[model samples]
Target: MDQEKVNILLVDDQPAKLLAYEVILKDLGENLVIASSGREALEVLLKTEIAVILVDVCMPELDGFELAAMIREHPRFQKTAMIFISAIQVSDIDRLRGYEMGAVDYVPVPVVPEVLRAKIKVFAELYRKTRELERLNHELEDRVRARTAELEASTAKLRESEQRRSMAIAAGKMGSWDWDWISGDWMWDEGQYRIFGVSPEDFEINPANVQARLHPDDVDQLRKAIAEFNKGTRAYETEFRIVRPDGEVRWCVGTAAATMDENGRVVRVSGVTVDITERKRAEERQNLLAREVDHRAKNALALAQSIVRLTRADEVKAYVNAVEGRINALARVHTILSLSSWQGAELSRLIDEELAPYSLGEQIKLAGPEVQLLPATAQTLALALHELFTNSAKYGALSTRAGRLAIDWQVDDELLTLSWEESGGPLVKTPQSRGFGTRSLLASIESQLGGQAQFDWRAEGLLCRLEVPLTRKTAAAAPGKFDTAGSAELQRASG
Candidate 1:
């Protein structure tokens, strides 16, 4: 279907006019030959086959009319198309003379660009069709002499194709079967025996045996499909589950076409059954991920609502800052969880992220074994650490250059014990009442994570101890509600 590009000859005495003609015909994707005079055009025509000629009628010597006459007189260019472009009005007598000189079309002083392109396209396409027909006539005679060899090659290719089809069916885990249900006759290929997990020597080719291998839930559905196929349905498709001999269940899909007799009765059915177990499993995993994402999104929204509801400060800006700080801490935890596929977050990473803004140097020391916290626990602990860091930057060990803080943790007796001690800052004093930060911190360890927190306000600084069970219970409090459930002794220990 791909045609060769033909040559379009643009002839004019003026260089600018020839350049303009080349620009207009460039997009036609044809080979354009430009000539500044009729003599140059004639030389080009003698060297190349021209399909369409655009000639300026007012050339200095051997003008458009004279040039067309000379081209038409040549035996090889007798039928070549010529279009004349004139910069002056042509009288009716001039037009008659131009037609006699082999001009097929003419344009006035100003040409309509679209009209000129349309006229040239028609002649070019006609020339291409004529050339193609001549080439086909030459090829027809040679085709008759090579027909026998082509037939032999086709036979060999068909045999190779059949072998490739069998290999493809096996590689694809697909099996083909033909069943004459009316006569209780069934035949299966090698791939079918593999799919059914049965050996041909031990398996009986019967409908009852096949039915027995189908899952009980899918039996009726497949039977209905077969019934429809037998009742004049030309094609039918169904998906079902099959239980193999070793108690392994697999998913499969069947596509079949019914062969009908002259009386419109289906005599036989043939089709392919493809194993779709892997595809089914992938779909199940995708669905599970969708549900998990939805659940986690709701939980995150609820946690944000809780931070907004529980946060408290004297000024509006203070309250907003408190809420934002806690939410930002929660967001960081979510980021860590996402990076780990929501499996968990490392305890040290969470601590480092919260304390990073404080710019703590050698004055602060940290010692802990690597521990991964669940999503809920990580969120709660991250918020608690953010509160602790905010307090230290404001009044505790990190408040002065001379101040010091040490954090350490260890796992013992199925419990993780983390201690935070501070020194060399303002004198410690216990608060008169528990604030939002203290209440949230207590709730995180006790209610949310099922742990304990004790704060000792010594004269030098503050020391806090937290104890959380390794196999902790799920959080008892829903989001948007920071549970205040704890022992009075623990409440008294809050600073």
Candidate 2:
């Protein structure tokens, strides 16, 4: 449907005239629509809009004058030009009649082809000019629509920009500022006033007023940063504390960039400051927790090293087994402490874990108040309990079928006292000298836990008492005294 390109219609009864017209107008480079009768010409007009019409005057039934009159009756062809071509001579009256039927020009018989071509060319150029004007009008309308859309978008963008600034301040919980050093004026938004713990009316809007709010300890550092900025530093960034007017201290971070003048001097500084007090406090707490974990880990490793150094064994396998057992007792204490987030461990729990191998039915009795020991104390007490169980198993309570053991403890204020008694076995006697297990047990209770240990060996059985403070941070506080149980002995045992 290219309206810019159109066809020329030729109506004649003979096929020869139609062929001649096609050959003559081939050089015009326009399409030619041919029809043999008035009825066929009307059909062509219905299908296509043509630039001009050329009709033969003498036809079989419907002649050129009749067809031209019919074309004039339709309003769609009002602007189309019609020409008459006859094969014979015609009278002036017939020519006048043809002009009355809307004929623009009359072509005589055997007319010159050039004259016909010249007439058709004029009308074709008019058609092309009309179509070109229409295309130009459509293009102009499209451009106007695009420009209007762009203007609407710019208006919306300006409105959203204001809203975006407010949302940014609320989400980030930060504030912006612009300092015009030339005017000595400071700009503070709502967020900035909140960070400084001041109201808009209370702020003086001057550099000196801002300087007064800076913490005394950090004022010099901020001054140095400002001095560097004034000297043309590209970036300004620092962290400092601010003492608000309400007497509250807060951590803040400042970042800014200075705008320079043509004279190479700082003219304005635009920046933001964020309140970071909560973040700083969280970081401090994390550091403290990490240090505490490191200290405890080191202490546990040192205690293992001490066990390896102090244990006396003849074979490598025996030494490893003994050390592994002692370390396992300490690990059990740690596990109990972990259940309470390392706050403390229950004394009864530690004792039960260490004596799990010994079935406590008739021969063993355990009685104690519910007492929670500190982490270090629990670890040391576990190993000491292990040594006590080993001693009773080998020579004291469990050596005979009828032997029995009784353990009981009581707490009074800061003091925790424990007693262990063995009976129903051979007559009790003290060793000639202290062995590795005996010395380790005494050192663990007295040196590590700041506790006192006393052993009494009677002829019938053995009795021991242990008294430790409820809260002893370190062994260096005070050493507990150990009393010797000087009695008879058949074996030099190490308990």
lDDT string, candidate 1, 166-246, tens digits: 988888899999999589699899988889899889999787899999999999977798779766899999899999999
Residue 340, candidate 2: how far off, in angstroms? 5.7
lDDT by residue for model 2 (135-175), tens:
88888888888888888898789778867977777666688
> Would you give me the overall lDDT of model 1?
0.83
The predictions' CA RMSDs to the true structure, in order, are 20.4, 7.9
lDDT score of residue 102 within candidate 2: 90
Clashes of 2: 0
Clashing pairs in 2: none
Which one wins on lDDT?
1
Q: Rate the local accuracy (lDDT) of all candidates.
A: 0.83, 0.79
> In candidate 2, which residue ranges exceed 4 Å CA deviation?
1-177, 184-213, 243-253, 272-294, 301-328, 331-342, 356-371, 398-467, 472-495
- Local error of candidate 2 at residue 322 (angstroms): 5.4
